[model samples]
Target: MFDTIRRYTARLRTSERAQPQGTVERRAHNLFEAAAVYVAARVEDDQDRIEEAAAWVSPEALSFGVSELACRAVVALARERDESPGAVARDLLGLPAA
Candidate 1:
């Protein structure tokens, strides 16, 4: 049992390490996704994506007003861009804001 567990754990770690890093790693990304989800959730606009995104946001990231605004901005941009909310959120977050 111990040997099996160790082998699986190693494989999991290796698989995770091989994955490309994305916007979810950034504090800004967390904030953007959280806010977008909260707003989208209330309106039932895109609950599936929002719920998935909400899992990645932390309280520490949501504490800032700037982050909240960024989230709202992402949702708005998602609408205007006619893109998936999650994808738009990631795009906005990946770029340095002007």
Candidate 2:
């Protein structure tokens, strides 16, 4: 996961350097950053930060990023617990075993 984020950051830098000086850049925040901040803000009940992060990307993009983050987190937790991802995810949500 960290490797994937690092590669994405590297790609972002390379793309930025390749762009013409006069071109307008998109939002400064990446989707992953936005998703992380947004999720953290929600967990902390920080509406202002949630709004700020949400503004960094389109709603659909944010949703996709959040979903990806959740999947990665579940997989990590599953590995740590020597359990299945589905079981980990269900446990996180307080759901009963299948």
Q: CA lDDT of each candidate?
A: 0.68, 0.95
Candidate with the greatest TM-score versus the true structure:
2
In candidate 2, how many Å is residue 22 off? 19
Instruction: Give the CA lDDT, 0 to 100, for residue 57 in model 1.
Output: 64
Candidate 2 whole-model C-alpha lDDT, 0 to 1: 0.95
Per-residue CA lDDT of model 2 for 7-54, tens digit only, reads: 999999998789887888765898999999999999999999999999
Error of 1 at 74 (Å): 0.1
lDDT (Cα, 0-100) at 50 in candidate 2: 99
**TM-score of each model, paired residue for residue:** 0.30, 0.72
User: All candidates: CA RMSD in angstroms?
Assistant: 14.1, 10.5
Best lDDT goes to which candidate? 2
Give candidate 1 regions above 4 Å deviation.
1-63, 94-98
Residue-wise lDDT of candidate 1 within 1-98, one digit each (tens)? 99999999999999867767663544445566576566666568776865665666666654463466766777888889998778886665695333
